[model samples]
Target: MRTTRSYLALALAFVLVLTGQSMALARTAPGPDGQIVLCTGTGPVAVLVDDQGQPIGPSHICPDCALSLFQALAETAPEIAAPTSWLRAHPIEFTLVFHSPAPRPAVARGPPQAA
Candidate 1:
């Protein structure tokens, strides 16, 4: 099962590579359970959602770029008590943004909407 998930992740990475978005060396940030693995890419933050496609919390942003992760967490710390499980992670925006010179890929897979 781990291998399968790795393959899936690899394939997604490959697809990103095929596009013009320039990605740096891979880095992943899985949730406390390790099942919800977020990563660095060219786009907006990944939204945490429930099974019905409703957002349970703010999107998870990449740590290397933009603002401090600690600050982002502090702003949203009150939402840690949400119930139920997520159906799947969705990346959004598809912007090639990063702190360094490398062009990042899509940050998350969900549609673009206000937080």
Candidate 2:
């Protein structure tokens, strides 16, 4: 019981951390045509921007990034504004996987002695 509760607490903490990290950045990101404002690795990137639609930091295009919401929605489907042909070139794909806890091994005990 304790282990399960601890695991849940740990999971909650992790979720909060991730949520906070994502919220730290502005909700807005450059549109599909929008360029990269600033990025660290080839994966996740945060394109900085001022009130105006202008790059406040170093902005560039991420070639490694398979796809972004703007691109996917713009090209694949008509969710946001008009569709874009550019997203066609740079396709984006997102995958989700589910994980399950491993079963605990059965404990062994010696035969009970006669009372």
- Compare the candidates by lDDT and give the number of the best one: 2
lDDT against true structure, model 2: 0.63
List, residue by residue over 1-115, the lDDT tens digit for candidate 1.
Answer: 9999999999998887764242232134333221233565875556565555555554344535545655667845545667688788787867776766678786868867887
TM-scores of all predicted structures: 0.18, 0.25
Question: Mind giving the per-residue lDDT tens digits that candidate 2 earns over 23-50?
Answer: 5443443433344545557766766555
Predicted structure 1, TM vs. truth: 0.18
CA lDDT, candidate 2, residue 22: 55
Residue 102, candidate 2: C-alpha displacement in angstroms? 91
Error of 2 at 14 (Å): 0.5
**lDDT per prediction?**
0.57, 0.63
